[model samples]
Target: MTSHRKSLARVLAVGLAILSTGLLVAAQPGWAAPAIPAAQPVAVSAELTTADADAWLDGVLPALLEREEIPGAAVSIVRDGRVLTRRGFGLADTGISGNQPRPVDPERTIFRVGSVSKTVVATAVMQLVQRGQVDLDRPVTDYVNIELPTRFRTPITLRHLLTHTAGFEEVYANMILPAGTPVPALRETVTAAPPDQIYEPGTTPAYSNYSYALAAYVVESVTGREAAEYLQDEVLRAAGMATASFAQPLPERLNADLAQVYPSRHQQPIPFELVGPWPPGSLSASAADMAAFLLAQLNTGGSALLNQQTLALMHSPALGEDRLGGLAAGHRMALGLFEEDRNGRRILGHSGDLIHSHAALQLYPDDATGIFIAVNGSGARADSATVLRRAVLDGFADRYFPAAGPGPSPVGTAADHAQAVAGIYGLSRTPQSTFMRAYSMLASVQISADDAGTLTIPLLTDAGGTPVRLAEVEPWVWQDSEGHHRVAVRVDEAGAVGAIGVSPALVLLPKPAWQVMAAPVVAGSLGVLLFALLAWPVRAIIGWRLKAPLDLPRRDMRLRRITLTAAAVIAVGVTLWAGAVMQMSGGFSAQPGLIRGAQAATALGALGLVPAVWRAMRASRQAHKSRAVLATLVALAFLGFGAVALAGGLLLPDITY
Candidate 1:
């Protein structure tokens, strides 16, 4: 791995360990959505005895809380319409010693539920569909006033948005808006930065917050009500989730019980996260509140939210193979639910993360059981939360609903298939057309093969980055050592591996050597730029030390010094300018003044090298020896850096989005 790859891996790990708060977890291995076919969600008759289920959670939840240093967490188990064990384990508001603290009340204390709001919002859309007021297959423009910009001729429909096949590129603008910012209406926020459709409608799957915002926009326009209002009356309230509110900041009545976000175990709590598009990820609710929705899901519409038929359709698979980037074999996309195949049994659920808060809601309809986990704090080691959550859920499934039999005979771990899948893989969620896509290098996703013939995917490793050897279970399907997760590879027509689906939420594909190698070039070239900036003064000191003056014409020496200084200044100034832009909110969407200055400086830096190149050439021909050679290197290095900056859009003329 190169320096850039290491740096990017750290960035990706922290980013994923956290999924931009543990969302789409472009960073951590366990955080990704592995492939599971969508076709198998069923309503088989199954049940869980409350005593065993409650005993298991009682033994596990606190142990995880203690081991992981998670400040507060709530777990709810709903068995056949009965709240089995919905309780809190730690403090909800661990206020600073000088500040007032509130212990968690799982039944009443509300936590920011993250993207689980998508599921809730989807239910609202299905409710409208049930009423004949909203058609899932109808084009969105038919319901909303705005038009989605698309390269494809197919129109985006409500059904496409529901299944996440609306094809809108991911948009993060004000998605997690900064504190103290006024919350914008859902429609205003979606229209503010409408993402272009990167694929034809229903042709691909990309996890997007914007898609749901548009779906909510359609819901609002059709009903003449905002999303929060509609969800409050139609979904949250009807499902008996009284403690749940889709509003960004909780309503005044519920604000007092709202939980604060903690980025680290010991760091002072951060301010309330204000999301502009509340529909996508802004719901704040208690574990008990979330259970009501789960109950509805497991029972297939016990609430007035939607009819049983619409609810079943909402839970049914929307896309099968996920044409763009294949999802895990047994996982599939439904209206809002992610139907997961695990342990020879099926589970439906969704996970949410906004950095400081993490949540997972799972429903096992066959067993008539569902589980919800919400953690109130996060840190660099946030993968602990994911592991803990999955452990409890998988443990419940195993203990309560054990696999009927053993899996297929395991092929040797070090099979030819393992060697074939080996190599560097990059996250598929990367920005393809934008320079922001350059950050994909930071992901540093890789799969290495051991002599055991087993493949080790580092991302799937434990918190310590120790990889797990995976055995090929079937063609293109690899199972983890623990059998808890699996990877499905997609091959092109030539039968070459094109991409690997870890889950419906993420896909990994081979990264070209040039891209992996670009990091070293960037690092080495940047170092040269710094040296060029220092050369003139250093050379002057050398001359003073020897008590000698320059032998070259004053004009040539002056030109060399001046041009080198310009190149150095341009390079350093642009770097500082970009650093400043990165500090500001929404810098990715719009460049700040420093960034513009850097762009201008990079251009000036490129031109500054011309005189230095001429001086070096003149000196070289005259046998100036070392001076000419060094000058030539400086000029070339400056030009290389400038070209890279320009091409990569690191500097101003290309700054506008």
Candidate 2:
């Protein structure tokens, strides 16, 4: 696949791996009364019992697994602080050579529950808060001995860290390393290349693994114990998650029981993955063990893990309601979880992705129920994991907790409001000052509007992979037809759409027309340059075969050579950069030297613009207007390409992404 397509696939995988609706919003001016009648949601009847859950899961999961070509999955369901059922489906490890396939075991097979580790780490920090060893409002710098290169004046606190509002740029460097790669100290790993902080603390939510790593470092600083050690003692042990561990290169006893992960069902198992930000997303545990952790969070089992009052504080909305505006109607950030309300019930959950293994954990606190599902394979399609994850969550909710749904109908001004907000949005979780900024462009989301005030975002989809269609229900607030997901927007003082909130932990900021068109401009310019340069070889062969000596002035000949050489260099540089990005297993940390070399080559090519411009002017003075136009076209194409590179920070010395 082309580098552009590959980068986009990776973005979609991560975006969907987390929940689809994950952004932020602020209040703006209110609008008028209803235009369209609201549609009511459908309700179904099903009791929450072990037998019912098993029957429901059997009817739903097996069909999904077979259709999606997923190898295996493990699930745990809990109610009233007790495990209702633990089930394993499909194979843990497909046959290798002549060996027999191993069936997944809910009690024995361990799966890496990626970012769910963030919830556990947040719990540890809260425990420290209860003991007076840590304060949620204190600046993180007070505990970790590292100063952040922040863009805003507000100090980053543990609350900001837990809620993903610290504003650190999204980074993927060293996120996953080879199994035997030596792990670094939390301090060193986090401090090595700190992401630039682009938003004020507590003002915007930008999902960040780096922020969680910093929070974990604070835990280490206060306790003088490795984060894993502290979590093992205070969190895991207390929750009765005996099989869980944050250790990379899992202990021999547990490693044997680890289910092999796969890119797809028909593919061979991938090698063991070592997570870099261990505290944020590196916990391996069985389905039964995960159930115990969920029960503790529900305040049923593992009550010693956290006190009731403290736990309540942790789960309550951490962001101020007034600051949230229309966003209050949508998702909101709690200390360690996303307040993803569904079917009128207040739900909190987090999704995790380890590339091969995808997991979703949801808590229906009011109903005293929680469900955990983790699959060993991401199906063949790019969005297979996303489809499966949403299906299980939505299916389970609809079966047992269905509710009548219909919010306020579409406002009279919905059409105009949708038009104003429809545009390409840049994710706040992107590198703002690095060459990786170029890659971030591929992750932009486009929101479209219809005359009826409905909106469509291709990135956010339902369980069936159809883009979730939305209608403006109120001023600055849009929700799915069934009210499963709510999206909110913020308008600037100038009355332009400023930001969008789809998830509690994420925000999408507006991208102006120029920024949105930059990639295509650069790509089109490359095509022009390549087309013009081809004339050089074509003319040489044509003239040689015809035996016609077509002579040109010495100055014109020199200019032609110079322009063609520049085009050649630009093409080679871009090709090299694309190859490097496609081959990178990690992020920018891979192939740094080669990427820098390409940057240098492009820099040298940009210098050709001066002579090309001079040549165009000189040619225009002569009798041949056609030659002048040709020269001018080449010069303009080169200029366009160079301009995008400079504007994107592609030629900048910084390579950290």
Candidate 3:
């Protein structure tokens, strides 16, 4: 047998071993797991099959339009390394009238696969790991020489970086370019600042662009090549994905059938130039090519990209207790690839999203089944992908692969109550607000009842439309499938809900609620102070001759006014910061490092003012002294703020809501 067939045989043998073990485990007394049906044979075919696949698509297409408001989409299904279906509907480019969206030709048409590029990058990184060129546990600073501001109490590892547990803030807010502004370099774009972080490294899982960008940087540092070039040569080319290419500024000649990407919500055609960080969310490929990539990974079990042992390490989830959607214990991110169990089957895959495109690739190692979908239009709902996946699974579920049995029903349904449970609930002793009105707390609950009349309370989306099911363990507390739990509501004497409590598992205890609220206020106040400080020189230049009540030089009068404004701003900032700390600390002493650092900085700046004032007084006695001193102070302040801003930009985590 050829290597491919031999590899297939070995996979089947492993599948059989796992299935037998699972059967034995299921037969144990008191183990009432759901029955998983046996796998039915599917006739292997070379040409694409549309009959059943099209039927599945038929149900999915309208649902996409109704739920996601997506005007059009394209989907493809692959079985045993073969493309079974490739179809498309609706307009690829919404701007052009009378232009019907063409069918997705698997041999042609490039669709942007967003974060899925992370998987490819992960694959490349794993390859380096396999070659002993990179260590997963090492500090990322070892790979890149840039000094990261040390707010993290614990050293950050590569695994922490990949799993998004490094406490990085979401930094993709300004990802897209507005109108005619030049697109900044990927590194520059990712490191822009303003909003800083809430916690230190490894404290929480906040999805970030910086992590992936850093991953890309690691690939470059290890391989001595740009991430795009390395991915194209190592992963794509090795997997026989010829049509795939990383997004770049130069537009390459495309095959006639390339799918046009449209802007989300607005439906404008999205140009490649607009995608800033290519490694994070900017790979273009056809559906067939995507499927081939998946097949190569599953069939070779990472051998196609790296050694067998490294592939095993990549498939092994490093997240021990940290939970990701649909992923169980022993299942987490390896490099960029996510390994998880769907129903009873072990699957390895990743999802991709750009502003105008959405794609998914799933590989079922045991059954040799692979599914890939790519959409060209913007505003494509995430539900569309889920619905399509369900349909595809349904096609194979009863006929080809049946469930063994129902697993244990998730615990308590009491917290779920009903749609009547759906609403904005208020928490007692309301905390101060950061970005919005204070004294009010809002929590949205979405309740969906299953066939058994058991209420399933899931977190509601921002739009308040759908209910995401939660995992039940206790009577009043509920956890999302991903393990983020919410506490049950208790009504008080007036028959009104008094406090909606959340369990400690969901809340970050690093800072108190009031302090959390005050941080932004402090930051904003500081910003205003800095702005006023900056305005001093401009005011001196513009209002040079203006006189005020004070018997001072006109420029000195301007300086005094600006100084008063800045001092007032700084006072507010300090007050808010101190108040927040007092409230949040709750008798718990502040970290000595953080407290001392802030105090020292403040004291230094304050002491420096003695010299500054004396210099200003002397300068004021001389002509243009006030203006020159004001200019000097403003320049110094700008430099300080710029340094803090840069450090803040680098330290902030990347998260997506």
TM-score of each: 0.84, 0.92, 0.57
lDDT of 3: 0.48
Considering lDDT, which of the candidate structures 1 and 2 is the better prediction for this target? 2
TM-score for model 3? 0.57
lDDT per model vs. reference: 0.66, 0.77, 0.48
lDDT, candidate 3, 1-657, per-residue tens = 001001112222322221111011211233222222223323333223558667756765656544555545556666665666766665445545346646556567677776677777778777777788888778877887555545656666677767655555433233444435455554464345422344455434445556777777778766778667788899889888888877543245653456666544345565552455546666777776777777666554333666655655565545442222111222334445544344445556666655446676666665666677666653454344444444444344333443344433455454344322334332111112121112121111224545432335332221233554544334333334432223343343443432233321122112234433332433443454466566656666666667432345576566555454544433433343343344222112223344334333343333333334544665656767655566455434433432332222211222111
Q: Per-residue alpha-carbon lDDT of model 2 for 295-404, expressed as tens digits?
A: 99888644768887787777777766345545555577788888777676667888887767778789887678899998888888866766787889888887887766
Which 10-residue window in model 1 sums to the lowest lDDT? 18-27
Q: Which ten residues in a row are the worst by lDDT in model 3?
A: 1-10
| Structural RMSD, model 2 | 4.9
Cα miss at 365, model 3 (Å)? 3.1
Candidate with better lDDT, 2 vs 3: 2
* lDDT for position 407 in model 3: 35
TM-score of 2: 0.92
Stretches of candidate 2 exceeding 4 Å from the true structure? 1-9, 12-44, 97-99, 405-407, 441-443, 548-551, 585-588
lDDT of 2: 0.77
